[model samples]
Target: MKATVYVTIKQNVLDPQGSAVQGALHSMGFDEVGKVRIGKYLELELNTTDRAEAESRLKAMCEKLLANTVVEDYRFELEG
Candidate 1:
């Protein structure tokens, strides 16, 4: 199975990196941007025939390492 995880800061968290990128983009002539957020993506491939087990394990992984539940949000999808 293949899993894709996306980790992003929550709406209430301050994202200085994203702000910097937006500023640079504006300086480069893209002035329509208002807000931006930086995130991390993780892709994993595993040998698992049981989807339920995979999902549970994936969630645990995200909770442990893939995302910081205190200030970030994360979601993942699994595929073959």
Candidate 2:
């Protein structure tokens, strides 16, 4: 099984890196761009074939290490 995780800052949280990227884009003449939020994308390969078990473990992984629940949100997808 394959799992993919996306981790991003929460809506109410401040994102300095995102802001810096937005500013750089504007300076590069990409004025049409507005707000930008930076995030993380992770892909994992699992040894288990059980979809339910994989999902359960994935969620736990996110809560325990993948995301900072206080300031970040995470979502994952599973693929066979």
Candidate 3:
């Protein structure tokens, strides 16, 4: 199975990197760009075929390492 994970900053947190990118874009004539937030995408391959176990493991992975629960949120999709 393949797992695709997306990790993003919490809405209440400040995203400096995202802000910088937005600023650069505006300077380059893309002035319509508004609030920007940065995030992380991750892909993982697992040997298991069971959806239940995969979901449990994936949640543990996100909570323990893939995302900082205090400032980030994560969600994932699984495919065979």
Candidate 4:
């Protein structure tokens, strides 16, 4: 099985890197882009075949290390 995790800054938090990228885009004439947000994508290969167990473990991984629950939010997908 495989699991993918997406970790991103919370909506209410300020993202300096995202802001910088947005500013650069605007300067480069990509004015249509707005509210840029930066995030992390992680793919993990698991030995387990149980979808429920994989989801539970993935949630723990995100909560404990993959994401900072205070300022970041996370979502994951499982595949075999």
Better of 1 and 3 by TM-score: 3
Candidate 2 C-alpha lDDT tens digits along 1-80:
99999999999999999999999999999999999999999999999999999999999999999999999999999999
Alpha carbon deviation, residue 80, candidate 1 (Å): 1.2
lDDT string for model 3 (1-80, tens) is 99999999999999999999999999999999999999999999999999999999999999999999999999999998
Q: Which lDDT tens digits does candidate 4 get at residues 10-51?
A: 999999999999999999999999999999999999999889
RMSD of each: 0.7, 0.5, 0.6, 0.8
Worst 10 residues of 1 by lDDT: 40-49
**Residue ranges of candidate 2 with Cα displaced over 4 Å:** none
Backbone clash count for every predicted candidate, in the order shown: 0, 0, 0, 0
* C-alpha lDDT of all candidate models, in order: 0.95, 0.97, 0.97, 0.95
Which of candidates 3 and 4 is the stronger one according to TM-score?
Answer: 3
The C-alpha local distance difference test score for the whole of candidate 2 amounts to: 0.97
- What lDDT score goes with residue 63 in model 2? 100
Runs in model 3 lying further than 4 Å from the true structure: none
Clashing pairs in 4: none
